[model samples]
Target: MHTSHAHTLEAARYAALAREDHAAGELRPLPNYALSAISACCRAQMAADVPDTTADLIAVLDSYKSPEELLREAEQKARSEQEYEEQQRAATDMDAPNRAKRYRDVGTATQVIPQLGWSRQMVQAVEYADDGRLWLDSNGTARLINRAGVPGRVVASSRIRLLRQAGYLRSENDSEAHLLVTPEARRALYLADLHPEGIHRDDRAAHAARLKVALTRRRGKQNARNEAARLPRMDVWAMRHADDLPATLTQQREVIEEQRRTEEEKATEKVCTDSIEEFAGRIADHLDDGWALNFEQNPYYLDVRYLYLVHTDGRKLRVKGENCGRDEQGAALPAEKLKVWAILPDTDRPIRSDE
Candidate 1:
């Protein structure tokens, strides 16, 4: 009749049902029953009345999740259990083609990789395995490591699946442990000391093939070294002249150089043919502050006869502007370089801020 004891019995009954259904291979309804059982457990701990209430128990039970949350958590646990069971089954399945070839000592599974065409990553994976398994060292830079070994190249985790697809990891893997390589790959890459097991060759021919692979690898490496040694010393005979290189490359160089010369030539001519404004502007630097300039030109020659220095507080000064010479700071500049406004030849104008 007690609510907590009654709910506890209910929980036990539901749990028993779940376990029985799971044993009978009828798992679909287990999470629903599991959720019900957990709800009962939660209610069992809630204070039914003050007499039965303990503050800690009541507070803890108050923290119980809503029904929907409890259901989701049960479903998630079920999924995890299902996955774990599947992995366990796979681990025990001795007849799987991938695992059955585990102990092979020799013979290529198939001609999957091309001759000398193994990528550096693939070769390193095979080369740096520990025992028969490649393990990870948990580090940012030290990825794809072999235990206690020098750091291996950072191969992507996805590359493990590729090795499985290739024949190198063609055997010797536990269900989810894809890093365990086959004996043949281990012997060829690491040990070179395997007498075959149940899967493949068990003789002199296997050892000879392994040696032949090693020899081929060395010869290829030597050939690469020879070519590398010759590379810097050798020059391309076709690229000896501008025309000998590709026309587009020659044109690119010519285009940039031509742009440089075009601007440079204008700058060179600028020294001789400066605008009259630019020539007159220089005189301001030599003039004291508050003093401005104006000019009137000769009728036929490129020269001014009347040039005035006007002060802001109403004062005017005149310098004889005909054929005058100046220093680098525009001191006493000649009249020819200072006059351009012939339209106002008779009028003297103040050089305001707008000028």
Candidate 2:
């Protein structure tokens, strides 16, 4: 009849009742407040049942204001049991959806076999054997490899050379190719293979579509501008007496100022023009009122200047043009070209141009 033992039994009873409510499909967890009251009641009830001295048993029951309060407290304990079970049901149901998206080839070793003897190191086990020949294991099961194979001599040499040219591989040996996949490459390959459709293939297709649209729009604008610039002048009278028209100082001054302004504007436009134009259309498409445009004047060249544009609350774009110089660390930055930027509230800026 110790108070601590009474408390332990009371808490255990609540736990057992909660489990029963879970079996009955009730949806919540037992709260601590109700359990404390249940413990106090158990202590009082046990004191009476133990056939202790009449004064001690009466004193234990008298601790409560009335029998009604004790009964009401017990009813709250039952409600706590109901609530505890409800919470457990909710958590179990929530995990079920995520489990389906995860593709785990567990337990059965037969389903997954290590890929071997591939001609290329980049070939992962996820890719099915090509050319109707099982280049992987001699066992001939569709080798679903969770990893990439080692690069052979041809892949080490020629394939590495090809990869460097395509900007996929870089090594100390300019001529000698190094055929090894880094841990980052392995992870990328694994993630790409995990999807229903290959990630690289989907990305490549989307990139190609974007490139096609960009090229088309660029060429269309260029063609239109060229056509306008190439049109014949309609001045037959000026051609007959070209030398007679004396130049006025005002007109000459006006022409000079116009030329200077055009040169400055062109210089400013160079800094961020290409990078901005390429990605600006995407930003403009998504926002209203649009981004801001700015330019930087190069100290070395009077006519040469960098241009930049910043969207009020958008991306932070960086540009690197042909005129920019590398730092001591061999890092390149935008200088003569336009470096367009979009302002974002957060620390992580949108760098769509580079990555």
Candidate 3:
């Protein structure tokens, strides 16, 4: 009935068509076509005196200017949404895959240190630097949540040493210090410890603002002192050997022994593999030694044999005259001629739980 309502309905109709056309894979919307269609439909309704329908049609057309206009708007909105989602995913990845919790206080943070002997409050959040130094988030503010925290002092040192020796932590950053832990170290710390109490150290709040070097960074200075303690007392041999040949012989012997051990392992592996193949082959061929076996030709021989060998390490070998090829004597076969199949040496052996 009202002109404004009729215009609005027509505009809405055009927008609906434009969206549908976009979904139907239009290269670009023909805005003029959409607008004309809506206008014609509105006029038709008006001529019929269906004012309500006319108003609706007008509204639909007015909602969007043209098909081209609607396509551009939708594309922009979609792009913005996609960009936002990508940024969110990137942020999530930086926070240790699926873990989001931050360790800011010593009490809360110590739960992350593996095998650390220091009190919870002394170790702060483990941090990495551009230069190789394990910075203990000691008495410093956490950037993640902006809270103060402290790392265990002594335990941090010991743990860093262990990590370095374990070859998990590396001196990649190469600052004056020996090693730098990546942020993923936090996840490693989480795997090491999960504390029930929070990390806030009430007593150390005053010292919480200070940044700390991991105990590993101070190890060089401590090792200097250890060198003095390690000084060995020596006795000069008055009756020395005529030459250094004896010492050289001892070093050569060590190398020879190492090579021998390596060769032995290879030989053992070969023996085990050979045993498995021999046992498997005998079982696949239905012939028990000396026995006369009668059987229809196997239609699925390979499939049946594969199943028989499944988990062979657990079962004991039992050779019987089960349809093996008939022998020259035409008598039932005995187990002995079957070359008593050896079980895969180490595999067939029971595993010790302690091992």
Highest lDDT model number:
1
TM-score of 1: 0.17
lDDT by residue (84-120, candidate 1, tens digit) is 7668446644333323333331223122222212334
The weakest ten consecutive residues by lDDT in model 1 span 230-239
Q: Candidate 3: lDDT of 72?
A: 91
Q: What is the lDDT of residue 43 in candidate 1?
A: 69
Candidate 1 ranges beyond 4 A from true positions: 1-113, 130-133, 136-143, 146-154, 170-178, 184-355
**Compared with the true structure, what per-residue lDDT tens digits does model 3 show for residues 1-355?**
4664666567677767777878888736655657566666666566556754546655675585677877997899999988876675565432322233232323333533322322233234243322222343333211222223222232344434434543345553333333445434433344334452433342133122111222344656555345322211111221122122112334456889998777655533322123334444554454333332111223343111111222333533333222232245534344334333323322454211111
* Regions more than 4 Å wrong, model 2: 1-162, 165-167, 199-210, 213-355
TM-score of 2: 0.18
TM-score per prediction, in order, is: 0.17, 0.18, 0.19
Candidate 2 local lDDT, 167-254, one digit each (tens): 3333333333322343333333343334323222332343343344445566675564443222112133212222322333455578
Give the range of the ten consecutive residues with the poorest summed lDDT in model 2.
108-117
